[model samples]
Every structure is written in C-alpha cells, then in structure tokens.
Target: MARAEVREVVFRIRWRWVRLSAGVGAALGGLLLLWGYPQVQAVLVRSSSLRAEDVEATLARAPLLPSSTRAHLGVRYLYDPAIFDPPRALEHLRRAVRESPFDYRNWMHLGQGYEAVGDRARAEAAYRQAIAWAPEYFLPRWLYANFLLKHGERERALEAFARAARAHPEAAANIAELLQNEERVAQLARLVPEADVRARLCAFLLSRGALSAAVSLWRDLDWNEKAKLGLARIMIARGISTEHYALARALWCALGRRLSERAACSDDLVWNGGFELAPLREMVPALSLSTLGVSEEFAVPDRDFDWQIENEAGVMTRIAREEPYQGERALRIEFTRHENVRFSGVAQFVLLRPAATYEVCFAYKAEVRGDPRVVVEIVGARRGVPEENAVLFRWSLPREAGRAGWTLVREVFRTTPETSLALLRIRRVPADALADFVKGRLWFDAFSIHPIEDGVRPAEGEAL
Candidate 1:
C-alpha cells in the first residue's frame, strides 16, 4: 500500500473508535437519568407532604426544590414556634419568590417574613407586589391593610381595608376587631360606604357595645337599608337595653317612615297593639308560632316594638288567628304550672314622656279552673328603681265567674318625673296556695296606649 493510504486508514480507525466511545457514554448517561428521575420526584413528593420525617429526608437529599416546596417549608419554619427560624424562613421564602416570581402567595409569604423582621418598607413592597399580582384576592389586601394600620397610615389602611372588605365581607368582622376606637371606626365607615358593609360593621359594633360608633353607622344608612333584614329593629332593641331611649325612638320613627306604616311612627306608643302585625316569633320556622304547639320555643323579641314574651318555663304563648278580639290575631298564653309561680310572659317596650298621662287598654277573655288573676301594669324600664316604685300604673282584672266573651279593660295613670321608657306587661297575681298557678288559658288582643289629652283620669274599668 502507498504511505498516504495507510495514514488515511489509521485516522478512520481512530475516529470510529472515538465515535463508539462517545455513543457508549451517552447511552449510559441516559440510562442513569431514567433510573434516578423517579427517585428524585418521589423525594420531592414526600417532602411536599410536609410530614416531619419526610421533610428532613428531602432536606438532606436535595438542596434545590421547586418554589412551592420552598414556600411550604418557609411557612412551616416561619410559623412553627418550636422550629421557627425567621432568618432561615426568609431565606427559603426569598428563594421561592426568585424561583417563581408569578406566585402571589410566595410574595405574600415573603412580605410576612419581612414584616416579622421589622423591615416595614420591604414588607410593604412585597405586599404591594402580591396585591398587584392578585388584585382580587382578599388576604393580601387584608394583610397590607393591617400592616398600614400598624404603621399609623390610617387613611391608606382604611382604603385598603375597604377594598378587602368589598372583596370579602367577612373581613369586616376582623376589621372591627382591629379598629376598636371610635375614630378608626368612623374612618372605616367613610371608606366602606356600601349599605351591606355598613350593616355588617354596625352589627359588630352593636355586639361589642360600641354605642357611639353603632349610632353613627346607623345614621349613615339610608332608610331602606336600615329596614333591611330587621337591622333597624335590632339597633332599637340594643338602644333600649342600653338606656339609649332617644336613639331607640329615632331608629323606630325612621324605620316606620321607610316602611310607610303611619301607625309605627304614630303617637300610640304601642306598636302592633292590635296583634295584627306578625311578631318575629311567627316569622322563623324554628321559632314560629306553629312550633309552640309541639315544643315551647322560647326567645325574646329581636325588635323593640315587637312583643317581648317572657320565657317562663310553665307558660307557653302563641299568636292565635281564630276569634281575635279586633284583628286577625291575638296572644294566647297558657299557664301549666300547678304551684304558685310569678309569671309575666307578655310585654312590649314603649317610649313615653316623663310626667305625662297615658291610658292603656286591652281586651281579653279567660276560662280558668283556678283564680289566677292577670294584671296589666306600666313600669319604668331601666330606671334603677324598686319594682314597686317603678310602677307608673296598675290595673287588676275583676274575677270572672262565667266565661265572658271579649271584654275591655282600661286604666289611666301619670308617669314619674323621670320615666322616659316603660314596659307594658301582663303579670300573674299570685294567690295563696296553687290558686294562681292552675293550668288555664287566656286570650289577649287589642292592646293599646294613648296619651291622655287634658290629663283627665278615666273611670276604672272592669276586667273579664
């Protein structure tokens, strides 16, 4: 062979050997990857489960994981006080955010981590970033609002809180807890002016006894929204209980105008006196008048104007539609106790003028086996006076030998100088022995109160 041909043959042989070696190396690498991929994924899956042992294993196995895994681990270390490492948690969270910049939750975690370290500026930046990423989310906005509020950025914080509450109304309760003072509450009210949100905030204030804030919020609501869902009634009832008689009256009259019921805002002072309007007890299924037949469902009236029937154990009261004294319904009270029991189960709250004369009238018929006489009385409520001293007027029913059909009972009396509010109540007159506690039924209807013109005293009337 020629020399050139021999060199060419040698080069070809070397090149072929080199190519074969490279091919073998590539195949081995591929096989190793196929064998190891599932194990790596398995470790990651186990770590993601967040169990203590699995997390430890994954931590030892792989130093670099996905953003979500890092975020999870970050949360664990950030919140778990036993293993809490703020620095390490921040490191993990920062890595997670770097790995997946689009994940808003990762940003939120990062913000919280920064906040925990007292890096207010960085924390705010991170929170804003998270909110920018997920504008519709509630938590980020809520957290940002809290951060701002903590830093005394009241206006900005209120705006952020309003946004959060608009997104999720449940946030109102949390905001309420945060803004305990009246100023902050007013600021929040201004920011979130929607009636529903205001209503929720008002309810929270009422529950917390933030009287001024509650009253202010109630005034902000339009007449229609105030009447919605019986919120006005609740506010009035709270006012009466808290000795805010003026506020109660204002709410009652405003709501009456909204409802277009002249009688509600009229001078009668007794709402639903004829028992014509369905009381709250007759509204709900569980607390309805129908349930009174099966079980004695007891609850006070939610509205100040509605009758607040006393929840005495042996007394059951319900609204009866048949044979009402004047209207479609009357209160039917039955006493089942066999022993002497002090009973005052039917009542209504009314606002009255101090030192003014008023007449209370009602019609009733009773069939009694025992001499359980019922008495009507007007007693000053929230007066901090002795029971006897608070009694502005009292009338006892004349004993009935026969079942007298519907009969009228009326009385006139002047109030004490300080009596601005009173309760029109029917109480059982306890007789010696079991006479007053005998099982008997009574029907009451056409209860009414009118300011006595010229302050004239009416002749004492007989009761059935």
Candidate 2:
C-alpha cells in the first residue's frame, strides 16, 4: 500500500466523525427544547398579571389553546392601551368564533372589536348574533342596546333597553336615564308592563327630579295595586323627600280608606286620628290591615299620616279594650318603671292650611302616678323652622287625674304662616327627679282635627 492513499482514507474518516457529532448535538438540543417549552408556557399561564406583549407571545406559541382563551386574549389586546391593536384582536376573536360559534362572549367581543375599527354594520350584526345565541341573558341585551344608542338609533335602542330591563329589572334605571333624557316618560307604561317595574321607574324618576312624571304614574296606580307591589310606603317616602306633598297625602288617604281606618280626603287632614288603625312596623312586600298585627323586623316607617310610634325604654303602647270613649279600640300607653324619660313616642304628621285656624279635640282617661306632665303639642315642622318657635299650641293632660273617667279636651290653634306641615305629638315633659317619673296607664280615643270656620260656635267640650 502507498502512504498517500492511507492519508486520504484517514481524512475521509475524520470528516464523517465531525458530521456525526453535529447531528447528535442537533437532536439533543431539539429534545431539550421540546421538554422545556411547556414549563415556560405554564409559567406564563400561571402569571398573576400579564402584559399585552406576553399575551401576544403566548398566542403565537400556543395555537392549540381553547377558543375561549383566545377570545379572552383578544379582549386584552383590544382594550390594553399600551398595545391596542383592534385589527389583531378582530382576527383572534373571529378565529375563536369560527372555532366555537355558540360562544356568545366571543361574538360579543368580536362585536366590540368591530366597533373599535369603525365598522358599524359588522359590529351591529355581531352584537345581534350574540343576542340570538343568548336571548335570555342580560349582558348581550344591554351591550347591544348601548351600541344602538351610540349609533343614534333612538327607537331601536329603546326597544333593546326595554328588553334588557324586562329580562333584569335592575337595569330599569338605565332605561329610566334614557327616558328622562328623551322626555319619553309617557311611554313608560307601554315600555314596562310590570307593576313592580313601574314602581322602580317611578322611584328613579322621583330621585332624578322628574316630579310631574312620577306623580302622574303614581296617580294612575290604584290602592290595591300599590299595596300589592309595596309601592305605597315607598312612594310616600320618596314623595316627602322630593317635596311632593299631594302625592304623599293621596297615598296615605287611599290606603287608609281601603282599610276602613280613620283616614279622610274631605275635611280631616289627620290619618288614623281615632286610634282605630295600628301603626305599621315595617313595609312588607305585600301589606294589608290584617297583615299588620304580626310583628316583624322594624324597617322604614310610614312617615306620612300614620301614627309614628317609637319603642321607648320603660314605656309600652298598645290599643286598650277596657274603656270605650268612641270605639272598641283606644291607644293605651303604660309606663312600667320610674324613669325621668323624655317621652315623645306617640306622634303624627298632619297637613294643615298655612295661617289657618283649626281645632284639635280628643278623649282621654288617665290612671297615671306622679306629675310627669304629659302634653299634646302641635309644632311647626317646616324644614328650617327653629325649635324654640316651632310650638304652635300646647295642652297639658291633667296631672292628677287618677282613674278618672274619659275627659274631653279641646284646643284651637293657628298654623304658622310658613307651616303647611305640623307635628302633633303626645310628650311627657322630662322632670328633674325620678320621683316625678310617670307610672300607670293612659287611654286616648276619638282624636279629631278640623278647620275652624267663621261664626262657628265655641263648644265647652267635644263629644267622643
């Protein structure tokens, strides 16, 4: 053999070895990459907060992720200001919807993406598709309604808003805002057919200063309807806060008349004046005279014309049956302990003609101990009236009347010029010593208040 031939063979062998080593190294590197990629992907997946770039990189690497995941990532890219790319988001959301056409959220997001790109027609179509997929769901309806509203499609937007509000009554406030802005309160009855929804709409109107509309809607609702829907007390409160006194008066009188209690619309302005009605402790979902006897959680009070009684310490109030001055029922107040309590528990708000004279008359029988000096006080309750000048009239109950028969007490008083609202309360003037603390029971009945007309005869006592 020649030496040159041997050298050439060794060179060819070295070249083959070098190529083999390179192939082995390449295969090992590919195996390592395949093993570690999932760990890196999982880290990104488990991240507490992810940037738009991170989401984009993740979508690029993991194409086999769920369609919902891809749609969510599209939302991130579409909304994130740092990397807001509507076209890229539209692509991702479109692909997601293509993969899972039944996903309403993907359709909704696609609509938003189309909206971002100023594609109104496609955006509206996508939103309608979402609604078709989930007609009963509120989100799609609300979003679609808002989209219609943004495009100045007023009538279509109102229809959509009504559908959304009907599906979820809590969304009625949104419709109320729209209606208020458009001055479309007259269409509320047609828009919301449900009575409960009307109540909510009325309250919203009142809160938003649509006083005339709220009052009009309230007037159309009957007493039974308001009672069934629990709107009587709610509207009364809203009326007082909004200074809609006529509405408040009408609600109180209507409820009182339905129960056959002592409420009147003609001459008498005081409600339940004869103590024939029980003060409601709470406004239940469904309310009536029969339901008021049961004790429940004390919530908001009927602050209109009904007697607003408070649970005072050491004082118990109820209707007594022992004595009959006018009817079988009489308001009875009993003091259990010797405490110098400033008792103002029994009260009612009465509407009166400003600067007009009226007579307040009542029958009471007392068996009280000590000289607590309970008085019937009529005070001006105008919002900014000073406490010192609030008292319009004061009549003291006999301090020493022990087990006395029914005494008819009468007092004539004139309302202040600025006072159309007055507080008529039975108060026990707080004494300096516990020795003057009142004990025992007092019974009252046949309370009445009426305007004093010209040439009216001044009676010595009132007949209960």
Candidate 3:
C-alpha cells in the first residue's frame, strides 16, 4: 500500500509539473507573438500583406482603428493608386465597422470600396449606412453623393445631394456650383428648401452683383425678413426708383400701408430730398418722379437739383449727420472764406410749371445769420436783370450759440410763362457786412417746392 501511495504522489507531482509547463509555454508564445508582430507585418509587405497572421496586429496597434476605418483604408490608397486592392481592403474595413457600428468612416470606406469594385448596390447601401450612422456628418453624405454621381445614378445622386444640403447647406451649394447644372441645382433646392438656404444663396449671388440671378431667387426669399431688407438696401444703393424692383416696392408699400396718410407723401417728387440718399450730390438726374418728363441723370457734374457749394474755392458742401429736422441727415453748407464778401452757400434747380406761382420752402439755421446779401430766390435760367435787394436773405433770423433750433425760410415766385426750369438759389448776396467773410456752418433740411392756389406767397423760414 505505501508503495502504491508513493507512485500516486509521484504521478500527481508529474501531472502538476506538466500543467505548469503548458501554462508557461503559452505565456512565452503569447509574449513572442506580441513582440514579433510588427516585424512580421513589415516582412509580409506584399505577399501576405492582407492575409498574414500578423497583418491584423497592424490594426490592433492603432487604437482608433475600430472607431474609424479611414486609416486602414488610407493604407490601401497608396501614393500610387495602381497598387490599391479595393476588394481585400473592403474585407477588413467591413469587419472593423461590424465591430464598431457607430463608425461613420468605416461605413464610408466600405462604400468607396464597393464602388471601386463596381458593386453599385452594395456601394449605395454602404453609403446609406454611413449616413444613417451619423446623420449630421457632411463628409459621408458628400462622398455618397459624389459616388452615386460617378456611377451615373443621377436620381439617387440628387437625393444624396439633397441629404448633403440638409446636413451642410453651404457645402452643398459649393458642390452645386461645381456641378454647374442650373436646372439640377434648382431641383435640388426645391427638394430640401430651407429659407435660410435660399437667403444665403441669394445673398451670395447679390454680393457678387449677380442681380438677375438674385432676382430670380428673390421670389423664393421674398418673405425672409433679412433677405428682404438686404435686397431693399441694394435697391436703395442702386439709386433707381423702387418701382424697378417689384419686391422693393412691395416692401416700401407694406411699411407705408400700416400708417395713416399712407398715400399723402408716398410720392415725393424730390430725389434724396431729405438728404438721405448717398453720393450726396446735387439733384441726380435719375429722379424717380417723372411727372415733368425730366430725363434724369446720375453721378455726373450737374448740380441741377442738388445743394451745391457755389464757391467751391471758398466753401464746402457736405451732408451732415447732425440733428435733422425730419430725417437722419441734413445738408450742411460751410463757408470757409469770403470771395469778396460774396461767399457760396447752397442752390437747386427747381422744375416747375409754366405760368405758375409756387411755394418754395426749406428749413435753415445759422451760426450767425448775417447780411441780407444772403438771399433765396426762384430765378429763371435766362437772367434778364439781377434782382438786387431781394428779400431772400432779408428774411432769416439768428439764434443763440450751441442751440440746435432751426429757422424756417420760404419765398414765393411766379414761373415764367414759358419756363420749365428755374434756379432755386441761396447765396451771400454782394452786401456790406463787415465780418470779412461768411464763416460758419448752416444746416438745411425738408426742402419742398409745390405750387399753391390763388398764387399766395408762401411764408419762408417759419420756425417749427
């Protein structure tokens, strides 16, 4: 019995040793594999490139591999594309994405692989899978759209482009521009139509001065407030009447229709009468009001109806941002020096009726209202006799310093029986005021010229 027990103990010890040896052998083998994997992968560069036992170790080395198959796919996409193997690359990419279902790039690369292998069905399915995984991602949708387009799947490609537009509209617009297919772009726009998208497109077109194109898109963005306002500003800058733009006119009329006396002042015969329009010149010839059949002009040397600095050598004329009587801006006339005490001020060419007694009115304030030589008159184009001692300047009253109060000035005169144009003039008449020169700024606003019944002379410079 003792001998039997000894043999059993020996057997038990031998079995334990064997099991321990097996465990140690496995540990050593695992360590060797871990250490030699990179070397083996390097050695299997081409022959067993994708099938080597150590090839998968390459993926394991990159921790982000499972999360994004892009690096693995990039390995297959060499600087020399001729060496790429789409089918072999796709096998590993599919396995990685199956392990990480949330990976968008994995699905995307799988789709690209399927496309390279000419499997259109699988390619489209893979692209859709990528989109489904990351609905807000632009790259997948953009790639999908491009892939479908490359395969001549036009309808599905448009749908994919629409998806891209929905994801990142500006990027989609860039692609649309690249496509240069106007009709297709229009159709794509209709499919995913967002007002902001339309507005952005319109704004881009308009910024490039693509007016007709912008006009075509305007109807779609008509109700968008920002777009409408931007278009209105563009129209205003063009200096053409709002009538040229039906949308702009609609906006203008909409604002007016909300108020009483909507039509009373809707049609002002003056162009930039309130001194609000830009390039602040004398009356521009592109006057929207064509009642008198005046062929308007623009940005030229005609100060016909614009307030002018008669003595530009001695005075300066500018539109001021100071306190305006009615609008945000007013006309500023600064007299720098005395050209023999006859300094220049402001003037306008008034278009009036034949045999008409009209009221010419405007607001003015002087830093120092000087000599009656400064007069305002409606004189004919043909000067028969200079009307000396005219009450044009005899009528202005002065005010305290630093006060913004304006003195209203007006005068009435009869139009010549055959006169269609008259000079609405303001100047420092040749008078004897011993200030040496007319120095100081005078602001004017709310200029209006209209005929009254019974030829009553309108009072000038009535303080408001």
- The model with the greatest lDDT is 1
Best candidate per TM-score, number? 2
**Lowest summed lDDT over 10 consecutive residues: which window, candidate 2?**
289-298
Model 1 Cα displacement at 70 (Å)? 3.9
1-464 per-residue lDDT for model 2 (tens digits): 66654444343468888899999999999999999788566745742245656666666776766787778878877877877889989988999999999989999999999999999999999999999999989999888988988988877887888788778876666567665562664465557677656665665655565657766776666556753335566556556555567767787676656655454567776666776666543443434222322123322333566787775877888776777688678888888766676678888778777888898888888888877588888887653122557798888877677866888887788877877777888888677655666778888877778999745655677433
- In TM-score terms, candidate 1 sits at 0.70
lDDT of 3 by residue, 351-454 (tens): 45677666666777666443324555655542222234322222333434224587666666566576654555666555443454345677777877766776
Tens-place lDDT per residue, model 1, 1-464, is: 66654444343368888999999999999999998899778876775564645765676677666778778888887788767878888988998899899999999999999988889899999999999999999999999998998898988988998999888875676786787776777678788867777777776666766666777887877755533435566666667767787877777666555554533566678878877765543442222212112111322235565687765877778878868888688988887775675788787778888888788888888776656667888888773122556888787755662385888877787888888888888888577654444557778888888998765877665654
Q: Which has the higher lDDT value, candidate number 2 or candidate number 3?
A: 2
For each candidate, what is the lDDT? 0.74, 0.72, 0.57
Ordered list by lDDT, greatest first: 1, 2, 3
Flag regions of model 3 displaced more than 4 Å: 1-71, 78-82, 152-155, 170-172, 207-209, 222-228, 231-438, 446-464
Which stretches of model 2 miss by more than 4 angstroms? 1-49, 174-189, 209-212, 218-229, 260-264, 280-302, 339-341, 383-388, 433-439, 454-457, 462-464
TM-score of decoy 2: 0.79
TM-score, per-candidate, Cα-based = 0.70, 0.79, 0.49
Candidate 1: count of backbone clashes, pairs at least 3 residues apart or interchain: 0
